[model samples]
Target: MFTGIIQAVGRVAAIERRGGDARLHIAGLPLADGKLGESIAVSGVCLTAVAFTPDGFVADVSAETLACTTLGDWTVGQAVNLERALAVGDRLGGHIVSGHVDGAGEVLSRRPDGRSERFTLRAPPALARYIAAKGSITVDGVSLTVNTVSGAEFGVNIVPHTLAHTSLDGLRAGGRVNLEVDLLARYLERLLLRADGGGVNLDLLAENGFLKQ
Candidate 1:
């Protein structure tokens, strides 16, 4: 699990394709602090560290991950958001994020909003249903709140700090972003899918034992 809070900014040092899998070596990172077997969120995708060096680390990107995210668009010198996995005692800074990219979204517009940047995205049709006003959304691995949502489009507020700390600052209009919907919302919606037991109302909260335990 992750909180969408970016810990460091990393750069794409190299991308080596080996058959269907890709070995990515990311530099410009403080990997000295990263343990060899730790889980790291590389632009919102959870990947395990296979090796650690002085500058950064190496993680294998499978064909599925490359097909699912904007990581395929990456090249040398590109900046990316990097965050270590959440620990048991870590504070929930952003929201519960699974680092599972549900689908991809396209950047529709990006511009300055006073001191911050306001970005609008056109999410995939199926993924748009999970978006809500003021709800959480992860774009290119950065957790942001939806300011408004409508017709496959949603807006998010990006502070200057976000721009400086993460790769989101590099995004422009017409760019594509990796999107991951909320994990809890997925389970809740799936429960509703099984709700029509011949109009029988099952205590959803009760069945899941979700209430005060």
Candidate 2:
């Protein structure tokens, strides 16, 4: 598990394709404290550190992960967001992130919002229902709040500190990103489904005291 707080911006040192899977050698992140088989969040994907390198680590990307995320599109020298797995006592600076990309999204627009940048992205249709205004969403491993939601599209504001520390600074209108919806939203949907054959409704919210009586 992770907190979606990026620790470092690493680069794809090399990629070795073997059959349907690929092994990635990532550089520029300190791996001294990490050991072999440790879990690391590589741009919203939980990848195992199978081996350690002088400056970074190596991880194997499965075919399924490639097909589901932007990792498959990564080229040599591409910048990637990196975060070590959360320790037991670490502060939860960001919302809970499973490092499992739910689906990919495309940036529809990026406009300046004062010193910050406002990004509008379109999530996969199936994943859109889990997103909500003021809810947390992980984009390329960075946790952000949904400022607005319109159908499958949502908006987020990236502050200057976030831009300077993460790989999202290079984002453009057509760029694709890995997206993970809020974890609570997923479980809440399941609970609602189990409570009734139908999904969330006004009656359910009222019964649960989520709405005024």
Candidate 3:
């Protein structure tokens, strides 16, 4: 698990494609060696590095990951958002992010807001329902809140601090980004599903204006 707060912006030093997997050696960040097996969120997708080094680490991207994320597009000199796996004592500065990307999304457009910027991303219709104005979503490994939602697209306000700290600053229109809809929303949707055939729709706990609109 990760909080979705990017700790460092690492640069991709090399990528070697072998068979259906790719081995990546990333640089530009101080990394610790993990026990043979460990999960790290690289640009919002949880990946396990089979090996490590002090300068960086190596993670293998399977064909499935390549098809589901922008990892396949990464090349030498590219910047990537990096976050370590959540530890017991870590602060939850960002919202809960499982590092399991739900779907690939695209940047629709961007508008400047002085030191900050506003981005609009178009996600799949199925993922759109999980989003709400002001709800939390993880984009490219950075946890951000939605400013507005419209059909398949949603608006996000990005402060300069975000641009300075994550890979999002380099995003361009039409660029693909890894997206993890709120983990809480998935759980809620399941509860809703179980209620559909039900005894009592406990969702009424939220129905009747109990949950803020």
**Which residue segments of model 3 deviate by more than 4 Å?**
195-213
**Reference-based lDDT, each prediction:** 0.86, 0.95, 0.87
TM-score list, all predictions: 0.90, 0.93, 0.89
1-213 in candidate 2: lDDT tens per residue? 999999999999999999999999999897778888899999989999999988999999999999999999999999999999999999999999999899999999999999999999999999999999999999999999899999999999999999999999999999999999999999877877844476778887898999998
Q: Write the per-residue lDDT of candidate 1 for residues 115-176, one digit (tens) a residue.
A: 99999999999988899998898987788999999988999989988889888988888898
Over all chains combined, what TM-score does candidate 1 have?
0.90
TM-score of candidate 2 against the unseen true structure: 0.93
Clash-forming residue pairs, model 1: none
Check candidate 3 and list the clashing pairs: none
Q: Rank by TM-score, descending?
A: 2, 1, 3
Output the TM-score of candidate 3.
Answer: 0.89
Q: Could you tally the backbone clashes for each prediction?
A: 0, 0, 0
Q: Order the candidate numbers by lDDT, best to worst.
A: 2, 3, 1
TM-score-wise, the better of 1 and 2 is 2
Determine which window of 10 residues in candidate 3 has minimal summed lDDT.
193-202
